[model samples]
Target: MAAIDEQIEQVERRFGVQLPEDYRLFLRSRTGMSQFVPPADDYLMLDSADELIDINEAGEFQERFPGSLVIGGDGARELLTYDFRQSPPPLVLLDTAASDWSAAIPQAPSLTVFLDQFPETGWIWGGDSR
Candidate 1:
């Protein structure tokens, strides 16, 4: 738990943005979750804080969407990210393959709401799953 907090702190420092409070709480509670397997073949799952930070720091994502933190993804192309630039922050789905930032879709208003919307099966392809 302490280690997770440390990792979260490190991410904030490196990214220059504070994570959503609910997300910070979530990380402190769980190490990681299973791969998201939504019905549409698209999926989303939480990543370890370390991997979360690493993905945000990666060249591909950085070159395309700066100031975005990759939290999870569809396991193949799309990415679920927290757009720090937005007030209150927003969870967005990025189309990685196309490298088209405009194609990004807003998923939730905040991390807490996003988690609540996750399916019982642990998948999140986007729907009224909550």
Candidate 2:
């Protein structure tokens, strides 16, 4: 189901950053995938507004990966995030096993591009392909 504006506001307040237009639009349209959705596992399953805060806070992402916010994951080690380290933050994949900057793989130039191309591009674990 679509997320309410208040939910999005809570996320913004928790993260202390204004989300990109594309991402906000996504939230307005659909908060995340439902359990009944296909491609249920090991895929980029987006987190709900509350889940976004809980997961990021639990992981201590700000201290560990400054300027980054965990948006979703593969239900395991791989995480989908927005790298706020750059202007107009790019979407990236982070490995939980590796705790360094090198572990990050640039997925797309922006959330807009990622959402637009994900169906065709899919996930790339080997290296950066965007």
Candidate 3:
């Protein structure tokens, strides 16, 4: 696993934007995990630092949303992103087909709150099958 500082630097350099403190801390604690389910059934699993960078660098989403950094996805067409233009970086869900970022749904104010509210196993609270 990459050191937290190294990961932070790599992310900022590649994405051309600074990561929020909470998200940085989250990466420090959990650099990456495999096969973990998300709270939302419609969304895909959260990706590791390397995987996320790869997804963004592929230029598929970046070409559409230039400043948006994709942090997660639904494994289909939708993506969960951090809008770098906003202070503290609010999480937004983007639909790839329509490229309708103007209707982006705000998921959380910061990564810390996002994780705290929707933990790895948070789906259990709603009795959703994993």
Best by lDDT: 2
lDDT of candidate 3 over 29-59, digit per residue (tens)? 7755434444443334566766667878764
Model 1, range 1-130, lDDT digits (tens) per residue? 4778889999999888899888888888887665544543336667878787677777677767877888887676777788877878888877776475676777788878776665533434454223
Cα RMSD, each candidate: 3.6, 3.4, 5.6
What lDDT does each candidate get? 0.74, 0.76, 0.67
Candidate 2, residues 7-118, lDDT tens digits: the string is 7888788777888988887777776863323342235678876577778887556777888888887667888889887888888899876676678888898778876677
Per-prediction TM-score, please?
A: 0.81, 0.83, 0.73
Clashing pairs in 1: none
Score candidate 3 by TM-score against the native: 0.73
**Which candidate ranks first by TM-score, i.e. highest?**
2
Q: Any runs in candidate 3 off by more than 4 Å, and if so which?
A: 33-44, 119-130
How many pairs collide in each candidate, listed in order? 0, 0, 0
Q: What's the true lDDT of residue 35 in model 1?
A: 57
Residue 64 displacement (Å), model 2: 0.9
